[model samples]
Target chain A: MIDSIARPTAAIRARPVLGAASVVALFVALWMALIWSPPDAAMGNVVRILYVHVANAWLAYLAFVVVFLASIAYLWTKRPAFDAIAVASAEIGVLFTGLTLVLGSIWAKPTWGVWWSWEPRVVTTAVMFAMYVGYLLLRNLSNDLERRATRAAVLGIVLVVDVPIVHLSVTWMNALHQLPTVLRPDLSPTLDPRMLASLVAMTIAFTIVYAYLMTARVDIERRRQARIIEARA
Target chain B: MTIARIWRIAAREALAERGHPDGFVAAITFVATLILVESLAVGPLAAGQPPVAAALFWIAMAFAAILATTRSFDRELEDDAIDAILALPGGRDALYGGKVVALTALLALVALVGGLLSGVLLSLAIALPGHLALVLVAGVLGLPPVIVLFVTLALRLRARGALVPILALPVLVPQLVAATNGTAAAIVGDATGALGWTGLLIAFALVYSVLGLTIVPTALE
Candidate 1:
């Protein structure tokens, strides 16, 4: 058990920066989509920023899905690799959710005439952000990795409602925010084909980046864990 | 062990907690303080006519519910019942499920007596009689996630009462919103759009039941 976990450590070092290039590439692509892309009459150039904002929102869901699965995997398999994946995924998911909120807030300012609103989606996403932050806070305050993972895994799965609730609250709250006009409500892919093409490609690109990061982090965690075990021995 | 036997074991363990005087006092005090704090708002509430006093009342229910939820697992942890429950081999789920049901029942009973009194006294602030049934239903449905949460922590941390409130609140916000919205709707005779919010609570309960059964054993271990 110890030998194999230790093995992945050196493997990760030998191939450091595995995912950095692809992530950089994705970031550039998102920038191009936001800056160089054509602007619409209604929302102007500000709306184009949504490509990145919405993509991060989608990736928040993606990261959470990974966290949830990894949680179930850890509980069922009792594997530390699964715990590392869940924890890493949750951290990354929090970053994306935060970015979504910030960028979404910026977009809202120019468009909605206010800085913040109490609409269901806004409240729910705010809650989602808070939930992940709380997860990290709880994990940090715990002394043992095993206990942290156990508690965090249970939390990861149980809190899955945050995503769906955020999605639904956008449409239902009817406070200050309008329902989703493009991605969900219409489901008809309303953007210009060039933009639509870029959006899909951007999502695919991000998924690949997610994979690369997942493997690198898992391998790094394996090594760090192995070193701890060896030091204890 | 038989299903009935497992349930009995779980129920007895929960019911055995009657002697904890702090839980008894804390639950009542928490509810009373919230009502008193809320009553102080009657002047503005009447003056502003903010169109959502019932929502505010439900907010108190939510804040009140958290204290009661923590008491269940905190009591179990103090008594060392969690370790024994985990040792029972496939009994953790039974215990987990039974405890949530038991706790929700206990809280609803508290909510019924206390919430009714608050509703009557706070009537000038908000008339929410129609919200009572929905509030009770929402309370029962909304508590599982809260219960599973404290139970997970009570098993893992054992000594920390501080983190449960902080950790549970953000996650409970969605449930809290639903209960508040449903109660608000019920209070104003606007039950037409309340099902979805009520459903959110039901879904919260369902998620905890399944996930609690499956994950808590590993957590306890």
Candidate 2:
């Protein structure tokens, strides 16, 4: 049913090159950016947190985009393969979100004078982490493949709708959280060019890592399903 | 024959699944305990900032809301009527809607009762007529949209009871943030100033209501 629509070989082949060159190019860029970027006079060595923290946060949304896309494909095509992709994306999204939270905390302890803040961004990140964790746990608890995929697809799509709202909430709460400078219309060079280079590099590296993990996870699921069928037959 | 009658039957069947009294007692007891803890926790900081108490108050409410949501669907699953109810004449939307209303009403009733008592406990002593009343009503009313969302997610969630906190907590962030802002403004004596927060809460409530309406049926289907 799935192979008729998507040649598994294409997806499987598309990974090694897209994933590897992208990752290698990414890390080299990070080395050039981080070691070469000028450090701010205000927070000397500590600013390194920006590269990791920012990239992880970017990846969180990226992973969700994948989960969303895969879910849409599953619903439209009714493909088991796409359901596996959605699950894989969600799982990766959770890990990256955790990384974001941890990096935020590490950065905060040194800069914000406290480990945690009621700031809107921090709280929403924690919430996103928990929501996706729930998504994965729900998938694990269900036994039926059709039921699990259908349910996960529904939950996955519904939950992604909350992300932008969470981002907006930090500003809406009038709290300590700052708005993103990079994506907004107005940009005053927030960081020196090197740090920006590091972030850009890290972003690509993490994305490649995300793709590799998702493919591996989905392949694991596909094989497990195949074995189940083989055992039955 | 009518959609109205279908709604009524759906409501009645859902109601039959969950018999009330015990859940009411549990919610009340939990909130009473929360109110006590809030009063004590903020008492030391009370002199520095009254608004902190208001913020503390709503955090407690958020926790209590989660606790109460479990009982909403726990009964149906416990008595093994969930599948039968899903297969009802109108299908899962009707049942999900009925559950949402029942849970929202139950949460509101409990939150209202507790909010009344917490109002006396906080004793901000400021002219919070606008802020206090708005926060009081909105805080309780604000819960239904949230309860509907979490309960809807809980339907498919593994560890439904345990999963409530996980799924609901993230979605509840804005609600909590707004409640804190609105209540803090009220507690600090600018009840009118708190109106913005209340308006935002209303907006959130509307969003969640639509979200619940749109998504719950799909989850059920």
Q: Mind giving the per-residue lDDT tens digits that candidate 1 earns over B1-221?
A: 53664578646745565655455467667766766666666653452232344455556555555666666666766778767877776666666666666666666766776656655665633344554476567756676556555546545564455666666777766676677676666555665645666777788778766666666656665
lDDT by residue (tens digit), candidate 1, A3-61: 97656554356444646656676877776677656787688777676677767888898
The fnat score for candidate 2 comes to 0.59
lDDT of 2 by residue, A24-111 (tens): 8766867765687777688887887787787788889888878888877886777788887888888888988998998898888878
Runs of candidate 1 with Cα error greater than 4 angstroms are: A9-20, A27-31, A171-187, A208-216, B1-17, B41-53, B124-131, B191-203
For residue B28, what is the lDDT in candidate 1? 65
- Report the first chain's TM-score for all candidates: 0.85, 0.88
DockQ of predicted candidate 2: 0.49
In angstroms, the error of model 2 at B38 is 4.6
lDDT per residue as tens, model 2, B113-197:
7766766666555467666677666766677666656666557555777766766767777677778778778767775668988
- For each of the candidates, the C-alpha root-mean-square deviation to the true structure, in angstroms, is 3.5, 3.7
Question: Best candidate, TM-score-wise?
Answer: 1
